[model samples]
Target chain A: MKVASIGLGLIGGSFALALQEHVLEVEIWGIDHNQAHIEAALARKIIHHKGSIDDLKNFDLIVLSIPVDAASALLPEILHQAEKECLVIDMGSTKNDVCEAVKNHVKRNQFLALHPIAGTEFSGPKAAFASLFNNAMMIVCEAEKTDENLKKKAYQILQKLKMQLHFMSPKEHDKHLAYVSHLSHVSSFMLGKTVLDLEKNEGEIFNLAGSGFESTVRLAKSNSKTWIAIFKQNKAEVLTSLKEYQQNLKEFEKLLETNQFSELENLLNSTSRIKEILAKK
Target chain B: MKVASIGLGLIGGSFALALQEHVLEVEIWGIDHNQAHIEAALARKIIHHKGSIDDLKNFDLIVLSIPVDAASALLPEILHQAEKECLVIDMGSTKNDVCEAVKNHVKRNQFLALHPIAGTEFSGPKAAFASLFNNAMMIVCEAEKTDENLKKKAYQILQKLKMQLHFMSPKEHDKHLAYVSHLSHVSSFMLGKTVLDLEKNEGEIFNLAGSGFESTVRLAKSNSKTWIAIFKQNKAEVLTSLKEYQQNLKEFEKLLETNQFSELENLLNSTSRIKEILAKK
Candidate 1:
């Protein structure tokens, strides 16, 4: 199997490496808008060769793992240029826009809208690893739109990577991700910003921050370009989630301000059920 | 050395375990208002004996690891019961109130206020581990108030656990912690609350949530009884930190609402510097 990995960053590079690791016979070609990323991916052996979208005939699978905006922008054309047997899989965070981009295309059957829910706070080819998708959740959006054979091909590869697959519509995917993923990113970024602004002493934060602070603000280190594209493409859902989150914070503030200790404890205890929810994972 | 661990939960139990692991001669006695905790600690070998604060005369060190409210409530009397060379260390999150409560006490020189910057989302004796404090930060407030000899004894135990110690005034410790530690816990709890409220389908959150969501909301699982007490004790500082955090979130909302993509990206990029700050930890 020959694969083309678009945008040689964490997601794309990791997928390329995972394929090479799990699939017995696999060849991955790296493509990135940044020359540095291409060079890094090649040096890291994440890909066998540097390739371009124009050379699509040589590839059996194309993984689009760029920012959502770029993924949407390039999806239709990538699908247009793909051969009948070539599977074009998108691994972007936002599903609806890119799925919509190629919805009416003639080669829609060859396109798979995928969102493998795996990542680290770090980015770029240097941050990639082969086991990134192992035991990770993979959301397959609009799977019915893909041809049966291509869907089977995608599933086989996902199975090789040990990904747990779930199906959801593009809209549902966006809504749920806004709450579970994107909103958490926003909250983490804001928490980091607030602390940075208020605590002028970086040394103090360095000395005082515990594992809790590290984990809570970990997502704040996510790539700005990638997240901005996501927040933009899924604006409505993201806004709704953020509004609810802000309201909760406001209510938390009021409880503290008004000396409502018991009510505050109630709120915290209820939310602590997240422990059980996550423990199941 | 004889150590009495009051309120034998995560911190207290973990400390007792660490002492047993690192110190050559140690006998630990447990004391908790909750009989079940005492039983659990004894069963888990976190304590050798079920003891009481009234038995402080039998111990060389008394560790008060309860909620801040209880620590403040009982600190003075515990100090009053301590022998001349006995050290009574309060290991609660908030330091100001507890320090204030014992400020002018007759045994002020025997009481030390400590805040170890180490913990997990889980609590209780079941979660206790000897290595919990290894390579973790320890905030030592009002160290100068403690007798030099007793402070040396406290330092020896902390050193045995491999804790990095930093000294500051009680006021300074509470203020810094409100931003770095307390605020993160509130943000995490509220993030969990917002997601739980919005994503009615627990299955969706369970399936779609990634490592990012897990880390960001990890602190939500912290013991609510413990957090409420800390928040109450550090009310003024925590409120100020929350106000700044709320303001930052509102600004973030405005940026996304007005389509200020560049500014949003900048905000994210700036906060991403938290990566560097935390990496120093």
Candidate 2:
């Protein structure tokens, strides 16, 4: 089947590479607003040929892999200009804006919102690689709004990527992603900021950083271009999540300051439940 | 060399294994207050045989690897009972209290303070491994206070484990560790508590927890016995570190609330410098 893989960054580029390695009969056409990305992706053999918005009519499927803002802004235009039978799907992190943008459009049933739960700290076409989505969760939002026949085709593509698909309403996906995914990035980035500030004089202490610190601050390296768009798209939920996280951190600070050792230990024990839950996942 | 490995938990047990693997003509005698740990460690061959605090005089080197409170409490007695030539060192996370405890002892020259920058969420004899110290930093505190010849023997042991040893005063070690190690655990545990509390109903969100979340919260699973002692022993500095961290989180929260997207993006960019520093480590 013919495919259009837009936004040749980590998520999109990886998706295209995964498709090429898994599906023998598939042809992936690349499209990106960034000329450098398109050039890099093509040189990396991430896609077969460069395509445009006008070329959307020639594909059986169109996958949006750009920043959330771009995907939300361009969805209506992509649907309006593309062929009727062309199934368009987005791999954007936030789903609400995209879902709302096309809610009343005539080709609404052709659009599906998806967030494949995978990524590295790195970005751009050069950061893409095969099996990036393998064994990861694929959260499908507003699935009921999409055409049934088109979803089956999309599901087949996801199956080839070896994703475990789960359904959620757009509202639910936005709130949940804010807490589990978005909040993690903010907390980690801020934690990195705290360390860099506090440890500037203790240059010797950097060597003391073990695997735990590395893992804890790994998301600090995520590019702001991609994240600023996500934080903007899910601003309300992110604000709420950050408020709750700050409250929790404040309480912990109070315990440490007051020398409430027992209470601090208990608070830590409550969080230990995450280990069991995460291990199950 | 005859080595008395006191407290056969993660650090000491792992030290025993490393010594067996690297140093020739070495006999490791394990000692612990816990009867079960003694049995488990002996069964796992983490120690050549089980010994007691009373056997301290029989060994050329005595390694303390118990809770900071216990290490601080037992150090004077161990030094009093041990031979004058025996080099006694405590592999405790906090240094100021332990150093203060034994500062005026006649056997002070035989005591050295170290904080090996290595560990996992898991603990006990089973957690011990031969290469746990490989390429990891060993923070040697109050080296000037210890006898020069004994410090060299200890350095020789560290070198055999392939450790990059750096010397610091107890004050420097405590304050630096508060930021570099202790504070990371606090941020991680609190992040876990926040997620566990907020995402209780959003069971589906767990599926979306990628490697980033796992890394940030991995320290939450660390046992309280060890961490509680660490937080207690280093209470003042831990409290100070927690205050700075809380301030940073609050500033980030304010930016999110005020919709200062550009400033938030800048903060994240500033934190990204950690990536280069960590890569070098």
Q: Could you estimate the TM-score for every candidate?
A: 0.97, 0.97
Best by DockQ: 1
CAPRI-wise, candidate 2 is medium
Misplaced by over 4 Å in model 1 are A201-203, B201-203
DockQ of each: 0.86, 0.74
TM-score of chain A of each: 0.97, 0.96
Alpha-carbon interface RMSD for all candidates, in angstroms:
1.0, 1.4
lDDT, candidate 2, B1-281, per-residue tens? 89999999999999999998888888988998889999999999998888988767777999999999999999999999888789999999999999999999998999999989899888889888999999888989888988999999999989999999887888888887887778888888877877777767666567768887887888888888889899989988888887887788788777877889899888778887887977786
Best by lDDT: 1
Which residue pairs in candidate 1 have backbone atoms (N, alpha carbon, C) closer than 3 angstroms, thus clashing? Answer: none
TM-score of chain B of each: 0.96, 0.96
